[model samples]
Target: MKEHHLKLNVLENSQAFLIEAVSKAIVAENDARNWQFAILNLVQSLELSLKSILAKKHPLFLYENIDNPKHTVSVTKAIERLENPMIGGVKFSEKEKKGMSSAIKLRNDITHHEFDFSVEYAKAQFLRVFGLIVHMFRHHFDIQITDYIDSNFIESLLEIEKSRVVLIEHANTRMQEEGVDSSLVWECSNCLCDSFVADKSKETCYVCGYQTSVEECGKCEDYFYSHDLRSIEHLFETDFCEGQTIVHNSFGYEPISICSDCYVAVQRDIDEQWQQRIEEDEYYHWSVE
Candidate 1:
């Protein structure tokens, strides 16, 4: 088999293990032990998936010396290297990066110290981890793991969802006690849960801790936000802003209405045109006369 195919098979096996771990964690009576093992397996799955992607690109990335067993890239190192690295047409989001970092930290804590673990926390982490896995499989490998989930597992997932709702309610109560506007809740993009308390002033989501300024897309007139596309003003300042405009909102501030998709399309088109021009030019001039 090709190296990429072998790496993909490894990723698939890791995902299968992750699914089993999650199912046991949710359905089993022992919360502490089950969650402990679940989290360990979760971290393992993430490591294997990341390493597989890196290995597909080049086996050297997974090992410092291909011949030596001792020399290998750590999980932390793999994550750091994958920062902003595009794989299979999908780029890792800042929220996903933060989630991975948080998972790693939690895993380390669980391994070293005797920390209090709750079903709610485990469920939340499961959602985040599972979401990442689904994204990678669907987008990166063009595979679907949904078929792997049996009916019993699906029922357990529903129970977990109910638990998550209760947790969100508790979170809202805590936010209210802390003088935060708990009424301003929004759906979290990361967990796809309606538990994200949006702080418009800070542009932060309290639930997932994601920070992004929401704006209406001028073309679609739909409100959208992106953690990655922060400095979009440069695009408007360039020739790409032929028909795009920044309009003053009711809040007395001008916000651009460029959605992430539109922004990407514009940038991609510009890059392709630039590359074509370079290819056509016999002698490209660097200095302006």
Candidate 2:
């Protein structure tokens, strides 16, 4: 067998994958299967873009085992490494992270298992990943995304991106015209848009057709999306640890979730009480003096 040396042309490979991804995306409007492949290519392109950035920092940082140099790190590892302050120091918003994670899951479903996605839903997820590609190209790599893809393809992507805006705007107008309660609407966990209706009987997202169960808030007793609730933790005095010289023995009680609004109100009350205590303490100190 003839021996061959492996060479990693990360940036060039990223450009090529981007080109392929957009080409597939242009044709993907009519073909669902094409959309699946486009998603795969787009995720690969993004992974390579991240690797290219890390490689610029240090080639070894991209590898799982720096000494062996046989296998590279996974996309998840690459993202974590990018955020490391000592390394790339790249930051991503929670929404961006959610998008990347959803894309990776979609890619995995396409590659490793049976999957089904409507054209609109697939495009929505695809756009989320594509947004990251654009971000990495401009912010991290310092390159124009259009440089790799043709102008026509860029226009196609622009059109595709417009679908979400139109869908969201229309949904908003419909809700307003119908006189839907603002408290019943929420930002979707999937599409990250304010198009989810958390009705007591039905919880549905108009933008992405995402559905989940809703819960009643402990304070307001109003129904909200599951993600909108914040888990509440309380410290309780433990009977077992009583009389122990331990520094304020306390145990975390069972967690209970409260709606965002109620949590904010609770926090505000705590802040007011804390301020009052501080003022009283200061007055007492001044009186003693």
Candidate 3:
């Protein structure tokens, strides 16, 4: 058997490293909701550390002679003020504070009590906050050992695949209502050329007997394959479907087409429903543990 010891510190280094290590575990183990929290804890720890250091630098911070307490005087602003007491005038904006406060609340639940981790909420939080860390890293405020992966990569991949599932459920619903023929058509959207599902051969199209030379769509005045609605990710929509993981990992490259403008609308409805599940809050169950 093998064992490893881990620790969190508030005395000197702060608990940021502990949270970060847990985050890596969450991501690797496919525990998204938990991963979301690990990232948040790490960020909050950073903010707290910065504020503490700044408070030490500018001991008179709370008495900066401002008549009103600004909604924007959040942790980051306090940290900066310590570095340059002259700019104690600037503070964290309300938008930044709201995001941070939400993060704090979420982290508290995961850390102090048992909370059901919502992957979407976690993904949303990361997309909102990682912008700051990226900036700090780029400006040399933070040291880099190697290329660190961020949550956006994870969220984007997740969304692309989740969106595909939404599209497929919608197609099945349509098929049940009107049958397959109407639900499935592969004509070139640009030239209205009949699309054939066959091996890509150098030979001319058998339908119109059009060679590779005459491949242009007469309707759109472009090559039938030029507009190439292949841009539409149909992996989930057809038997030609690639596996979910493949499509998920590809991000936008695997975008699915909803066919008509109507189908797009239809798909949108289904997607919203699915998204609601991921984002739905259960505040009633306040027990963190």
RMSD, each candidate, Å? 12.4, 9.8, 21.7
The better-scoring model by lDDT among 1 and 2 is 2
Model 2 lDDT, residue 88, Cα: 78
Runs in model 1 lying further than 4 Å from the true structure: 2-5, 65-70, 84-90, 166-289
**What is the C-alpha local distance difference test score of candidate 3?**
0.43
lDDT of 2 by residue, 1-289 (tens): 1111112478778878878988898888857899988989988988888888888788788798889988999999999999999987988899888788888888899999999877766787777778778877788657887677789989988988887799898888878886778988987766667888887655888777789889978777787777678865432223435655332322222346888787776666656666777899999999999
| Candidate 3 structure quality by residue, lDDT tens digits, 7-107 | 11221343344336334534633467556545655566556444434433342343333465343246545545644647433344665565666666666
TM-score of every candidate? 0.55, 0.69, 0.33
- Please tell me which predicted candidate would have the highest TM-score against the true structure: 2
**Residue pairs that clash (backbone atoms under 3 angstroms), model 2:** none
lDDT of 1 at 113: 87
Model 2 TM-score, all chains together: 0.69
Full candidate order by TM-score, most accurate first: 2, 1, 3
Deviation in Å, model 3, residue 267 alpha carbon: 43
Provide the global lDDT of candidate 1 against the true structure. 0.65
Query: Which candidate gets the maximum lDDT versus the true structure?
Result: 2
What local distance difference test score does each model get? 0.65, 0.78, 0.43
